[model samples]
Target: MSDFDIKSFLTTLTQRAGVYRMYAADDELLYVGKAKNLKNRVSSYFRARGLNAKTVALVSHIHHIEVTVTASEAEALLLEQTLIKQHRPQYNILLKDDKSYPYLHLSDHNYPLLAYRRGKKRKSGRYFGPYPNATAVRESLNYLQRLFLLRNCEDSYFNHRSRPCLQYEIKRCSAPCVGHISQQGYDDSVRQATLFLQGKAAELLRELQQTMMAASEALEFERAAALRDQIELLRQIQEKQFVDSGQGEADVWAMTDWQNVLCIHRLVFRQGRLLASKNYYPRNPAGDDDTELLAGFIAQFYLADHAQEGVPKEVVAELPAETMEPITEALRLSIGRRVSHSRGQRGQNRKWLVMAQENARTGAQAQVSGRQESARKLEEVKQLLHLSDAPARIECFDISHAQGEATYASCVVYGAEGLMKDRYRRFSIRDVAAGDDYAALEQATRRHLTRLKEQDDLPGLLLIDGGKGQVARVAEVLEELAISTVALFGISKGETRKSGWEFLWEAGAATPIMPEAHNEGFRLLQWVRDEAHRFAITGHRKARAKSRSQSDLESLEGVGPKRRKELLLYFGSLRNMRGAPKEELEKVPGISKKLAEQIFIQLHGE
Candidate 1:
């Protein structure tokens, strides 16, 4: 809760539209909502009732407020979700713990390929899942790989496999690229894999088991052993099967609010077994009803990783009647399945739904407890900056380099009282002459400023990690860009460049806000400065690696300008090239077999 008294501030409907944010003491943006009347909508929060005890606690923390007027409520909602996802405020129900969802990726090739993947979907392929967790999707992929036997090897490696790989010797693969298996056998394997993913795992397993028994009876021991292994693996997976319910894939989501926080838990049953269970905690759901929060959480959660496979035939969630159709239609199109939500009626199924709700309650409580330290640190920052309003969103910058080579700048943000690491950004010192610190600083600042102008949101405060010189430099950049109303400052080193004596750089003089032995403000700035330094150093390391790769390519003889690029693109990097044999190198567009052999010898002395 912010310190700003919602009870005291009166609504004048001062603006037709604007973005309103509700934040807690830790400066963590709890909830961001837009209004048709900026003041009227914001003022309404003071009178809302039935708010959870947790919600009241958060409201108690409000110390300051700021507003950015927009022209539309639609713009406000859009900004709200974006910031919620970006900062992940405490009051909004947020997906928990998982860094990313998993997917089953079918690789690009004439033969095609299948594998389990996570992170950004940059490669060309048909991806599915975003299953409850990585393990569930991975189990599914293992089943498919064993059934399909499609080559999972990288293209270049598969191309160079003159003999059948271990997968072939083990009978899991037909080794089509090396011609050990006929095109027909490979196609049959692909068909079975698809069926297993489409709620036919049990049927597929029975067929595979039967084949194993037949092979053993025919004295094909090796073939039988391979089949036996696949059978055992499949049997061991997804042990929590539902015998009473009709066999089909489905997802069950349940939500509960504790204090002002909401938690959602999902139980995913795929192929009639409980595949995975997950929990999500969303922030500052103050004044928002349970049904609304549940609806919004489900939409954003699914969108975050839409490529996952196995859309449950039904999605069971505890929500109001109105949300059901829109959710069903939206998911149906994305997953190509008939999606529906169910309310628990009695029996074991009803108990499971209760279990999902309990999970949500526990998760929300844990998150609120864990947020304490970060909140205290944020309050300290507010005091140290002497900001007119305590900044709920603060952005800090730092520069790093090794002897001025491969210079880089990093920006890290803290919101509502803690760091939002995902919004962190790194900028390569482009357009700046190498080794020129001032030029690098100027370039990075301008790029950041320009983007901020284009984007609808900006940080509440901007901090640079240096003395007066750095502060002055940033101010000049802002002035040149004609931006006003931005809080800017620099942090200078203390006595002997230690923590305690640091000064805040102001125009014309260095103002001291040195930390006493236990000053909260001093400790807070130290933490921020340290975090910025770490982020900047990490960026500098990455930039140096990229530079080294380019230098390596430039040094290769006969690789010249055009051929160098072709090699890098084909192989991905110099490391890949160094590992490549002559035969692999010959595939690069401009490289002949003779030239490839020369390269192999020159690089490896082979």
Candidate 2:
């Protein structure tokens, strides 16, 4: 499997903390990792217990490696991420996709407008959050606007407004758009808003009290009354937020997983009260135990922009003591302080940690129950379908095409746990006529049958997403492969157009087996059929798009891929090049005056 001489590389590696990059046979990066000792950490991968199914698959494809030695593990951690960004290795557990978390940006203006923002934060504005979800930010923003009469209008809208808008009429804004509130009054409101968002509500309340008292002494009764109303609103907010946890501020991190899929939940707390909670899902975590996962996650997560407000005073987690020590030191170095990172200590700290753990555990248990429920449905399917063997592994096939173009066949697999996403496959129908479903099924079934190396690998039941005609064709192919043990059935959404009531039939059978809408057996069948249909549509659409993109350039006899690529790169896209004049087209590196005219005519010709 592995062509690379890993043992010889092991001899060459030094016992130093550094980053190591692993490459696959095709010189593709499989994984990039950092370790306390390069030799020991890299050596452990060859050990027996360290190999999981995912890692084994990765290891089998390894070709060669590279190394960059760092002075410390922390530096190595930073370098690992840099290399990951550079290569995006298949085996590494990446931080997150490029989809950025949303935040609440308050503009730095005459009357600062608050709005939900997504993307890189600019330097000028005051941003209050890296909130978990849009709903949370919107809920908090809604209340913040109500409690403090701050402007939520756009800068353009505010600058051009002829009069106060509905926000002012609803008493949500101070009408600063039309100068209803003075600059000084608006500044005071913004200052309080800043304090409240900074998790310093008490400090804001005290400042409001002082302002109200001064207004009263100056005989400004109207101003004092308005301040009193604001103070009451702020107090009402505090009363709602004040928790009875009897603990100090700490950010709690807990992990829960099912069947190798893991989710880490982070709860940010202020004054013993939960401020915000966010969940992070790591696709197929590499750690063998909970401790390793916790330690690695702690290192990677804190190093990123996850902790926007710097590090919390205490880092509460349910990690092992051995795992905690080194991670704690790394965290201290990052935070520029000696942070308390421990778990299951005592009192309210324990209570908070336990609560977070419960959240994680409950989340994990839900995953387990969901899978178990699916398994039960499979069991019901076996009994209802009258099969000799349990239908633990079910395979469904579907055909998708448009009249006479871009025909595709999709095979979706389902196991006892649920949908086996990794085992899904799509085949483009070549020999079969474009709209012929029966011929398409026969061709796709033959391709799938050849891949079955062992009897155990064969599906317990085979389902076709058509009537008896399609089922009969698949059965003929199965007979050609001499695979008779696997049961065969056909599923058709009848003319009723309802989902649950599907007609099921055996191979070459005329009569349809009817199952109730609420039956778990019918539900399981429906799930598999729907997945097959979706997979077929996705494959068909992608194929059709590719055909459209390729045929456009390939239609020109003289325009080879190299020349077409050059022209497209210069023009930016096919659509752009269609309108480009021959003069502009000739500007491309490889195009000639004669060739450019031909391409121009080929594209924009009547």
Candidate 3:
């Protein structure tokens, strides 16, 4: 047994529906399971009693577990199947074939019947899907039947019908056999249903919108409302079916780094079905860009002797063509076959790429969730700082600005439990010289420390994103406040001004300590520093954008703060206000006809 911290992990585990993956000591995925409540389900394996020999063996080897939350149990089930099929973990009962996968079959009659099917596609006029399961297919079929009123009856039963069936009475079928609907009308319904099945949502929505408008123009309000309802239902379906698509073949590659752990996920599609997926964690010693990493991985992957047999005809990623060109050329030469590389900017390819990216991000997060890695980093921090015990809480501060405008300082909190986002604070630097980072840091630190002092709740260590000068300013703040419990350090970029070459300055120390590039403690510090920088920069940009967005309105004559607020409130946005006609502008409260005309003329430059 690998001493898995079941009790501690369970404390943070959520009671939501999700998929949980169990891993062994070597980071080998052993099992994947879905649960209605993640906390209860995962806890069952570690109970004190009632374990079978196989279950005991599986639990004994468990090192850590990771979870991906879903909105509902159905979604969790679907994602569970996806991960199971992709990884085929040793403890999972793998499906030997795609025979059990369900599909939506549209028959060849005048009023084509949409029905749930499995196994062979011999009787199909069009097979829309190999949906994850029969339930998903049935749900889609039920929705489509309601939206388009397409029939769902056997051919023999349809041919012998003398009048409308119950399905037709319920408005789920158009009853083409009894002439309740014209052939032209039934064909149009079939065409619309086809568009929905094929995942041409945009085109289908456009046609629906046009029909709704026509109905409105003819004063058929009831029909227009019904069309509107149908459109909404179609949109809902689209949101749920983001991964659903028609026939295609390609391989998707995505890479992501989470909590300093890098993961790359590859998804393979054949005949529009997800055949397999796998994850890789290549060492990123040089901290390469994603493009460089992906290019290298793709080249090495396809050039491998065993990989040549499964080389896809097309490869899709979130990389540009120029970056992938060399790899594509190399593949052609080595394999004597042409392979296309795509960015997957739109349609089904984009969806596949997005899914791959999401999986990569989640996989990286899972790897980082392992307690051993986190404990190692914390232990390194304790040794580097010469502390008797590992610090439970560390806070980092950074200042950001554009030349001399929209100055903001950000504080990010980190602890054994990972980032404490709720504890993060942003200070809008005031009464300080613009671009004077020292002043901003002093003000931000004084304010943050004052609050912490009153509450008697302070972090174990404080980090600043600058050198001795910045550290001195913060030290002065601590002295003025008469606070001495927290240790303080400042990190400054080395001469090359790159990551992995930062010099750390202790409070009141003249000399800076430069740790080795690969030190875990230094890496943890870098991650915290980078996070503070990102948060500060993001806050600064939002402040700058808000100032710039209001600049135009502020400059307009007779538009004081109150009037500007009213104009924005009434029009919803500046763009809408600019486009509003004078007559509409006059309708707003407190805007006279003369003022409205003047406003229009100024807005239009007329």
Task: Give candidate 3 misplaced runs (Cα > 4 Å).
Answer: 1-20, 23-113, 118-136, 149-191, 198-201, 211-229, 235-264, 281-361, 382-390, 400-408, 427-440, 494-497, 514-516, 537-606
Mind giving the per-residue lDDT tens digits that candidate 2 earns over 373-426? 557767788888887767868999999987868999999997765666668999
Best model number under lDDT: 3
TM-score per candidate, chains pooled: 0.35, 0.37, 0.62
CA lDDT, candidate 1, residue 393: 68
Candidate 1 Cα outliers beyond 4 Å, as residue runs: 1-376, 454-456, 499-501, 550-606
In candidate 2, where is summed lDDT lowest over 10 consecutive residues? 237-246
**Model 2 segments beyond 4 Å from truth?**
1-371, 453-456, 550-606
Scored against the true structure, residue 145 in model 3 reaches a CA lDDT of 82
Per-prediction backbone clash count: 36, 0, 0
Question: Which of the two, 1 or 2, has more lDDT?
Answer: 2
Q: Give the alpha-carbon lDDT of every model.
A: 0.64, 0.72, 0.78
Q: What is the lDDT of residue 603 in candidate 2?
A: 69
| Residue 418 CA displacement from its true place in model 2, Å | 1.5
Clashing pairs in 2: none
| Full ranking by lDDT | 3, 2, 1
Write the number of the candidate with greater TM-score, choosing between 2 and 3.
Answer: 3
